[model samples]
Target: MRREQPSTQEAADDRTDALRTEATSSIVGYRLRRAQLSVFQRFLTVFESLALRPVEYTVLVLIADNPGRKQTEIAEVLGVKRANFVPLVHGLEQRGLVERVPSDFDKRANALHLTQEGEAFLAHARQVHEDMEQELVARLGGEKARKTLIELLDRLT
Candidate 1:
């Protein structure tokens, strides 16, 4: 008796199933990383037209919400290294989306703010982000489950 070999699609499906049952599946950090990757993919899809990276969007929001805050403070709050964050700020500044002014309280520090164009862009980005979040919450079984997951994740941190 001869046995038939699995087709290409069948082999791919088996590999996918294997990944689901992998040892890392039981680990919280691994699972969280996988979830983050999935969510970030969705974010990219939703934000494709905006042409902004995830960190860029967050930086815009932070500067908009806390105008006149020092650049270093914003970078610290975001857990981004000062060296790495300077390029991000510079790119936004070059795009005319953000500005850095000499801090009144501290002459050595540079305070951050969004330009008019940045504000308008952020308003649209916020709407897109909210819509994407709503889609994620709905997929996660609605507002209650979303809130519970957020609380659990908060506890983990």
Candidate 2:
């Protein structure tokens, strides 16, 4: 008697299972990248309703915390190149979530500030973020493990 052929998805799954990742898995950078991708995937799903990306949420938080900071300074802190950072800021400004004002310290610079709408949106976003953090902490085996992992990761940076 002849056996039935496996379905395409089953064949693909078999191939995937047969692949070896041990070499890359042992690398710190590879593991960190894999972790980041997993976290970001969850982040995207959680923030989908708010129409926010991880970087955008990060930028908003920075502006809220450091109101009146120079755009260049904030961008530098986040390691975002000026060219790419400009369009990100412009999009936020166009959405009326952020505003740019002339800097008092540097006539050539623009200070960044979040609008009232931004403040409101960020307040809600913060709660959502906190929830996500709690879930991650639990998955990491609780707060102590989470803290340890963060400390180890910080050392790399």
Candidate 3:
């Protein structure tokens, strides 16, 4: 008797399982990259409609939480190049989601802050991100697994 061929989805699922069982899964760099890809895919699904990229979301959150922080300071914490950071901030400024003002302590450094519009947008964005995070937590098994994974990752960082 001849066996039926697997469907495309079945083949893909098999391939995915094979990837998880591969030696690369044991490597921190490889595993982290694969995990980042999965998380970013879900992030896109949640934030694409709002036209928010991950870096932008991080910047928004940072500025909202640390109002008056210098652009350079935020860039440093996020490990973004100054050249790249400028355009990111510019895009947010153009969208009226952020503003820069001269720092009171430093004449040269510009302090970052979320505009009223940004504050409102961030509220919705954060809710979407929370939903995405819950989805990730469920997929990773449960809250315990999520907490353990986060703790492990934090140790590395």
Candidate 4:
């Protein structure tokens, strides 16, 4: 029998399989990042039809929960910088999903609120999110494991 060289695709596959990740695999930060990526990937798939990104969804939920919260206040809680936060809020406002009105407490600051459309959209999003969360919970081995995982993650933050 004659020896034969692997094809280009086969070579690439071999290289990929041979790559090592052991150095990072056991690290807490690396594991956390990988888990985050995996979860976010599933989240993106579930929310694809809604066309909402993770941060946008978070912002919407925060505003919905705190209807009269000032933009700066929400941004601070989310740890988003003012420069980046401005464009994010503007995009939401342009989509007619959010509104910025003068803050009752601070004349110069804008209070965030969801529009009627935003509320309707959020109601749908909430249902979708709940479904996704249930799937994640099941994957994590039920509600108790999910709670424990969340508690551990919360400690890091």
Taking the tens digit of each residue's C-alpha lDDT, what string does model 2 give over 19-49? 6888999999999999999999999999999
After superposing all C-alphas onto the true structure, candidate 4 shows an RMSD in angstroms of 3.9
The number of clashing residue pairs in each candidate reads: 0, 0, 0, 0
| Per-residue lDDT of candidate 1, residues 25-141 (tens digit) | 889999999999999998988899998889999999999999999999999999999999999999999989999999999999999999999999999999999999999999999
TM-score of each model, in listed order: 0.87, 0.88, 0.84, 0.87
User: What order do you get sorting by TM-score, best first?
Assistant: 2, 4, 1, 3
Better of 1 and 3 by TM-score: 1
lDDT of 4 by residue, 37-118 (tens): 9999999999999999999999999999999999988899999999999899999999999999999989999999999999
- Residue 121, model 4: Cα distance from true site in angstroms: 0.3
- Model 2 TM-score? 0.88
Off by over 4 Å in 1: 1-22
TM-score of 3: 0.84
Which residue pairs in model 4 clash with each other? none
Residue 39 in candidate 2, Cα distance off native in Å: 0.5
